[model samples]
Target: MEQFSTMFLSFIDTWGYVAVAVLMGLENACIPIPSELILGFAGYLISAGRMEFFHATVAGMIGGMVGSIVTYYVGSHGGRPFIDRYGKYFFMKKSHVDTAQRWFDKYGVKAVFFSRILPVVRTFISLPAGFARVNMKKFIIYTFLGSLPWTMFILYIGWLLGDNWKSMLAVGHEASLIVATLIVLICLFYFIRYKRNKKRL
Candidate 1:
């Protein structure tokens, strides 16, 4: 972990905003790279006057959108058949696809929006949304809205920590889990309400 962080930090240091975009894109593309580490360090640089916060945030957001669109396209273009045939190779199961589909069906495009704030879920939500062929305009809009606040929040946290931004590497994980749990609860509540309303109708 330490070694990877060091290398990632170095890459960001050398490439500036481009590195931020690329790394954030990879993370959103369902890669295991953590956004907290990326944006947190970028915040650290902002503190040191090495980078601007606005530019950094925009770069990260754009990268995330692009990456998500790519995945969404893949999912739209026969992602289900591919998964059915060879998902085992990558440890991706049909259940995963089903869950995402259910969420999209139940909550509509809002699932795409809410899922963007989640850690692991955010990385792959696009695929299912794509598979469902959710309206592309709404998908992109909600995706941008959802990612903006998250990017800013992490960047601000990093900036606040300044020289201590590295601490977020650990703290951010715990915080995200807490946030994710709360979101799940909220979604459950809405799901129940929707079911009740449907029955009444």
Candidate 2:
């Protein structure tokens, strides 16, 4: 883990925005790169006067769009059978896929926009949107809107914390994980309740 972190930090230090873009893209593409780490480090750099926050956010947004586009294309072309076969390896299940599909169907492009602000949900939301054959232009626009704010917030937090940022980041990570887990549990509870209600009807 330390070696990987070192390599990742090296990549970010050397390549700057390009590394951020690729990392964000990969995070969206179901690779395990942490978008939090990328944005936070970028924020640290900005605080150190090494880069502009707006530019960092823009780079992150672009990376997010590109990564999501790749997933969308794969899901669109690969279809359900492919998702069912390969998704499990990535810790995704058919039920989760179906849930995302239903959300997209019910909410249209807004689902894409909102999901980008979520933690784990953000990673897989694009798959169902792609599979549902959502409008590409709308997907891009909503994704940017949703992701830009999130990217900016994390980066800004890092900038404000400066050299003491790592300690703040550790606290933030713990908080984010707790919040993400709670959201997942809440969503699951509601999904189960909705299913039971529908069955009775």
Best by lDDT: 1
lDDT of 2 at 63: 90
lDDT of 1: 0.83
Could you give candidate 2's per-residue lDDT for residues 1-201 as a string of tens digits?
568767877898899999989888988886766676778888889999988988898888889889999989989999878989998887566776777777777887789977776656677788888888889999888888767667877788789877766655466556355444655676799999999999999
Candidate 2, poorest ten consecutive residues by summed lDDT: 174-183
Model 1 ranges off by over 4 Å: 84-102, 177-201
lDDT tens digits, residues 1-201, model 1? 779878989999999999999989887766667899999999999999999999999999988999899878878896778767865665455666666667777887898988777656677788788888889999999899778778887888899999999788777657576556766787799999999999999
lDDT of each: 0.83, 0.79
TM-score, candidate number 1: 0.79
TM-score of 2: 0.77
Candidate 1 lDDT trough over 10 residues, lowest sum: 87-96
